[model samples]
Target: MKRNIVIATLTAAALATGGTVAAFAAGDDETATQRQSSAGTQVVADRDDADDRADDVNDDADDADDREDDADDRTAVATGDVDVTAAEAIAAALKSVPGTAVSADLDDEDDSGKVVWDVDVLGGDTWHSITIDPATGKVLGSHTEQEDDTAQVRAALKGSSVTAAEAAQAAAAKGAVTSVDLDDDGGSRAWDVETRATGKADQDWQVDLNSGKVTTDRSDDDED
Candidate 1:
């Protein structure tokens, strides 16, 4: 009977300490929740860091592409035999002729080993070919076959349905025009155009004055 009484007294003491045990358990649960929240925050931060790294990679690729394009532009400027760009050469030629520039090409064949820009201009009813030194942007000389070629062009236009401007536009499809001339292709009339390239020889394009058909010629010989 005495032992049972002692055991009952201990059970009473434990019941009186109920709030302390519950407080300790609540504190432990709160700590565990805080640790879980910290881990979740760390995971979010890691995802953000990953996203930032991917963006950096894309930015680097874009920068590389821009650099490559700039290098290509520089290479194109350096490959020309003349120091002047095609635009500058054309502008100088137009200042001398005051006409619509049809074509401009670098000609490295001067006897003095100097490079010149051969520009063709269409002004009024005549076509003018002006040569300019690329280094100085100075006019070297100019010539025109207007008297002879104009008469033939007029005669051909009288019989053809297509206009001169249209024929030139058709021929320009082959490439940039270096020179344009009117000539007889067998019995039919045609417009012969030479197209300029950066590193290659001028290409020949023929536009049929009557049909407005454009054709290419592989030969280096002039159609005249």
Candidate 2:
């Protein structure tokens, strides 16, 4: 009777402190087992949700990277008429002259109508003109264009950061870059780029070296 009275007093104190007492014997606790199962299920569900979210983020990142890579590819080789790209032509020219490429033009106006990439490189005091096959990307021929005009070309290229390949890429929006030239037209030195399409007339653009900006330039049709 005394032990029962002490237990009742302890129960009363617990209740007064807003505490509830619970006890479950091992191997005989169905309610506790059910609570543990429910908690395990909730944890699994949360982990699965986090994993799904991470997969979605990775997928999005992969898609974005693919799009950027595609854009870069298009910018470099969007011209469908020729297989040899401006960048390739510039690289070929550099291999021959080991200098800075100043101009590259895709020409098909020869007597036999052979398509070739004409690349001009500035090597020290000489300007080298290199010709490469459009289909094979092989160097066909090379010649010295001029030796005295290096000073003029150098002056025009001073403080210029945009290269011939970069100028071609800038103008390769709707078509492939047909020609890129370092020019000082209109008193401002910049790169003059021409893009050619299949059925449309060629378009001209001026690429500024100081800021990598592209703008419409004087077109050949403007003479009319």
Candidate 3:
């Protein structure tokens, strides 16, 4: 029961790291956190009940999605001089904040009038959103969000043998990475990568975060 809750929490954290949070909120909302906390408690209470556990996990995931959506809406557009690639941006973010580089993208801010790499990292119990100068690879700014599931995220990442950079390299074989998110695959955690290769269709790959294995590979063009 405890293990299940930990897994579920880590999974939610990974999925909620990227732009997905924008559809819901810009950052961690109090209501979303409360709801997730309640769901986690419910999971433990209903450990013996499979249906209840499943429902709780689903509810938790829904709340997480809402938060992620909110974040996505708040994320700025990627634009400007992009000399540094997404992979390089991830490297810079990881150096600044040691943990999982869950997501990264080019962001063009009208106010700043500068192109920046917006990267989200999960380190220990804190979620860090860092801004990097795409041209110089300099960390321009950053913010942190501490949530109830921080420990779970830390555990999941520390337990994983594969680093985010390693996962990106494995996925890079597909194409230039657009985004990389730590994701849960039916209790197994992996890095979800989207790549764009010149003269080829975009692709999605899943690399096992625990074993540095490419578990799933497919082309996005096929869906079209």
Q: Provide TM-scores for the models.
A: 0.36, 0.59, 0.53
Tens digits of per-residue lDDT for model 1 on 8-125?
Answer: 9999989868878888999999999999999999999999999999999999998986666534433434555346544566677788887655556555434344446677776667
Each prediction's number of clashing residue pairs: 0, 0, 23
Model 3: CA > 4 A from native: 1-81, 107-115, 215-224
Clashing pairs in 1: none
Q: Compare the candidates by TM-score and give the number of the best one.
A: 2
Error of 3 at 165 (Å): 1.1
lDDT of 3 by residue, 1-224 (tens): 99999999999888887558674574558678888999999987777688777889999998986665433322322232456767899899889999777677654543344456788888766799999887788999889976566555565676678766778778777766666776653465677877665556546788887677775554344566
Report per-prediction Cα RMSD to one decimal.
18.5, 18.9, 28.2
Lowest lDDT sum, 10 consecutive residues, model 1, at 69-78
The runs of at least 3 residues in candidate 2 whose Cα sits more than 4 Å from the true structure, single-residue gaps closed, are: 1-81, 219-224
- The better candidate by TM-score, 1 or 3, is 3
Residue 124 in model 3: lDDT = 62
- C-alpha positional error of residue 125 in candidate 2 after TM-score superposition, expressed in Å: 0.5
lDDT of 1: 0.65
Question: Model 3 compared with the native: what TM-score?
Answer: 0.53
